[model samples]
Target: MSNGKTKTDIPFRLDRLPWSRWHVLVVVALGITWILDGLEVTIVGVISDVLQKPLRWHCRHLRQVSWVLLLNRGSRGSYRFLLPHRQVREEEALHDHLGTYIVGTVLSAFSFNFASIAVFRIITGLGIGGEYSAINSAIDELIPARVRGWVDLAINGSWWVGTMVGSALSLYLLNPAFFPIDLGWRLSFAVGASLGLAVLLIRRYLPESPRWLLVHGREEEAKEVVSEIENKVSHQTGKELEEPNKTLEINPIGSVGFGTVFHSVFGRYPKRAVLGLWLMAGQAFLYNAIFFTYALLLSKFYGVPVDQTGLYIFPFAIGNFVGPLLIGKLFDTFGRKPMIAFTYIFSGVLLAITGYLFMIGVLSAITQTLAWVVIFFFASAGASSAYLTVSEVFPLEIRAMAIALFYAVGTAIGGVAAPSIFGALIGSGSPVNVFYGYLVGAILMAAAGVVEIAFGVKAERKSLEEVAAPLSEVIENPY
Candidate 1:
């Protein structure tokens, strides 16, 4: 990017200075992706029971049956008549009464836990991975630096919006008293999937990122999109769109696509990329360890009922909802390192205290709930901002792959393994040890923050291209 160019110049053409409807639509699309990203994480708990149950059919058999059903529905002619004939009877349906139930039950864990999540999580993670980077990049490209902070705030805030939606669906839609036990969780999944489809439909009206087009040397296309935007904004506001007087230049090196992330472009800024990855890993690990695994931990160790545990999750989600944007504001305003470091150190301390209180049985139910609310709030705030920091740390070229690699790996190691770690630690004792693990997690979280602060230079003031400079350059001035 040229020295005088504002953040907005990177994504829009000179003829279209003000934003257009296409710009808003793209932001909405990106926002939808973010919602879906968060929803997947939240919905797993709601459906856990359904997935854990045994299915009295082999994996191959199940796949074959599903395939057959799908094929039968697609054919227009004899398929309809044959479909009823091909349907499995209640007696023929796989059930647990036979000795196969025990074997099938054992097999279900591998299928659902290992196979299903392992496969689907990668798909989900890929979609999620694209979402975090794409939304930020699109916003960075489209919105000007002056109000860019607010646009980023709105985009970042969508994560919490997603959390609320997922939690509400889990709490209200999946409540068994209102719906049957077996069907409620399915309904929860259906609600999330429905929202995803709605987003896809809305996104059809959105245009491609002008900045991306510019970077790829498609100047005319970029200019056209920008004109469309300016015209729309002018019509809406009934005012002339004023253009800033500054020449813009795209970085020849930064314009490359996803392949460049792992190659020379990202290879230069290895340490910043690594630090971002570490932060992402730490965030996912600590968060999932707590949020994803909490209900089970409470039920198993504290003897809390599942219904009560689900109810308690509402406050946790609320805390998560509140944490990020406020922290993000401070991040950009005060600088990334200090805010992140403070968040981790304090968050760690809170986790330890929360764990200690739970272990010692020193608090009443309300007090315990309050403590959880605080702990999760801080964690949510810290974790969400961590993504913002990562977004700022890397360059446009490698941003997507870098974020994806860090989160996918982090969630797998820290998040997926959290519950088992808690279970192993608790064994049969007082559940307080779960908090001890959190204390350990806090230390790790703080360590990442401290490392980032000590090693991470201030990138808040720099353009996206400059911050992702080579490791040798970054090392020269780490403050």
Candidate 2:
């Protein structure tokens, strides 16, 4: 590896490894970020009313700004800005700053004022958004191609684990019978901060991605890291590993510019870029529209108390968690295009049925919640697959940015609009009004499925390099 160029087989070697305990370690260490995200989102959702009481928390604006910031800068641009600086190692800088920012945000909620909470939440969103790029890039590079689909889906699905925990906590903490009004929401934030603290400690042990190192001209360091991973996996599995069968020559580049990334994605892989945007935007619209305002819908239409809303969320979270766990492997087996389309279309159809029932006034609160469970059961897997699609289909150099770009675009186009529209419809006190909102979500989701069927990349079980050739790949002349 010299002055921005190297010929090596690091990508192939990393891809050919067998599934082992080391993979699990990587997943647990890196993927906990999603769980933290889930906890934060669900906590805010459950406590929306509490934050709006006489205290004037104005958490709605705080949440909206945080989310938009997170979607825009947090996922795509922030990591790139931070990684090149030498004041701290890339791994240490991200992990430490993320922990500090999240802890500080949660702690600020104790202040019970709008301004402080808004400031903290903006910082928190930036931190979490940075994690999205760094973590997704690292996980994709480190995990084996054979099992990457299942692992990515499972990690993304684990967000619902945090959701379930958040729901349970809100049920207990939001209850005035147990805790006073002001204290309950403050304690909920404290619990989320505690979880962030624990994840910080775990992140310390995670190594930088060897694939990233190889591409950046750190061949010796990449080799050393891979060797250590091989040793650990072999020891744990009690078996010898086979040699890698594939190799590719690469012209390693130092730093990729934003211009190159943009040209490569939109200029070279335009269809993929569109597919990713549709998948991500569709899910964001459906999820943000429903999940953010679920409590409001129940309290207003079904007469469910705010304190009891968490109980309904618990099962919904379970259904979401189960979807990816159950159907993730099919992405690898049945292939990406068919399964993604099926899940998206199926969930959309279910949501349409549920919304119709909801509009007709035939479904009670319990039945409505059950309908959500079934609809999201399929939706969760499809949403998880969206992340998988964007991350894997891009070249190694631009994978993180691609994920960030599509995520930001999708969030901006669909995610930002859905919540306000749904909130307004709910506030209008007419189920039929809200039905139109649900119809929009359903149509968008199903349209994304159709887009997948028409254009989705069949990337399941393919090495990342095979799915999208590295920008640095060399082509030798026959002459």
Candidate 3:
């Protein structure tokens, strides 16, 4: 265990720990970022009308610029290479960074002018992008193997919680009868920022990933972190933890480059790469196309007032949130491929039917919103599963990067295109036009579901190491 390399059982030890209060603390601390994101996105959507007069175009440009910058450089292959090293340099720094961004978002809302708003959006986007990589890696490493699926889906689904909060807030804040337009929007941002501050306090107590420590050759530190976790679990449960009898021999590797990540993901696991792209891109297209334009559809087609859009959004968010909470456990019980495919295909089918009804002028605003609730119930679970899939299928060494890469690529292909296309269709004042966009999204989702059926990995209840061996693992001989 010297000369820049070490053999260790740290990964096994971490994976075998029982679910405890400590795990819940980690989930609450880290998973709150998703809620922050949902809140930010919902606020922007709800307030789009308020900004239309003065800052609307500017805000839109800022959003596009921030997304491009973050997706391009933040998730690049080189960026992924540096993630583990960054975590090793300081535990909880990533969490602090996220909190700082939330603070910046609050400040941005108070900006007196337009340029400051753009700057704040970029800062906030960068922080959220960073959180996506770091939090996924940490959660996957810390959670017990048996329950990882349910936990991951639940945490990811929690985004809708923020959506619900934002919608409820907008119902009050966006109302001219209750609050002035300017004050309401600012308060919304303040509320989100406040949540971020609370998350920072909770994250302060989180420890570094012991698997990361052992792989980086910090065996003593790894052992210490694991021992502390075990002690807490034992005290809480009033039972002793069993010794880790399993061991893994890993020959530590030096830094990996973009070429290594490219080769591993595409060269060695080409089928997995394709499956990931399809699943991610499909969900991204469906979600972004609808979510980004939902308010517009309501205001334009249904005659729903802009301020009152939150009334519709509240229920939509509930369905999305409940989908994962209700059915997420089935991914573990029934198997990943079956459940993922079912959600994707089911949602896609439902979306097509809803879109057809919408085009024929048979659906009112209330019915349309209800249709969305039903469609996204399945779609949300499928979307959450997409994140779970990419995070789990890749090797630990490149887990962060893999999540980043898939997210960036998928977002670029589907997320970026969806909004623009949908906006144009909606602008043309034609329901039929929008229906075509829905069909495209629906087809992509269902096709991705088929791809999952063909190629998805059944990763439920399996150790991350067993699912995908570390690039640094040392093979043993039976001779």
lDDT (Cα, tens digit) per residue for candidate 1, span 1-479:
22221223533233234555645665676666566545645655444433434544222322232222122111111111122222222112111111122222122223433345344333334334444544565565566543444456557657756666666676665566787655565555455555666665665565665654554445666678777767777787677966655445443333333345455334655676667666766776686556655555555555665445556666666676676655656656787678767777677788777778777778655576678678766666667665666655665544444555555555554555554565456544655576678787877687777777765656564455455542212245432
What's the best-to-worst order under TM-score? 2, 3, 1
Summarize candidate 2's per-residue lDDT along 154-250 as a digit string, tens digits: 8999999999988998888999999997888788778778778888888767888777777777789988988888888889888788888777667
Q: How do the predictions measure up, each by TM-score?
A: 0.75, 0.92, 0.91
* Model 1 global lDDT (CA atoms, 0 to 1): 0.53
Arrange candidates by lDDT, highest first: which order?
3, 2, 1
User: What are the lDDT scores of the predictions, listed in order?
Assistant: 0.53, 0.79, 0.79
In candidate 1, position 148 carries an lDDT of 45
- Estimate, for each residue in 1-479, the C-alpha lDDT of model 3 and write its tens digit: 33455667777777777778988898998888889888877887777556644543443432442332233222222223344434343355466457656866787678665566655665676567667767777888999888899899999999999999999889998888998777788888888888888888777799988876766666788889988988998888777777777777776554456777888788767888999999989998898889877877787688888789999999999999999999999999999999999999999999999999999999998899899999999999999999899998888777777887887788778776776677678767898999999999999999999999999998999889888888775334200
* Candidate 2 off by > 4 Å: 56-97, 474-479
TM-score of 3: 0.91
Question: Per-residue lDDT for 245 in model 3?
Answer: 79
In candidate 2, the residue pairs with backbone N, CA or C atoms under 3 Å apart (3 or more residues apart, or in different chains) clash, namely 74-129
- Superior by lDDT: candidate 1 or candidate 2: 2
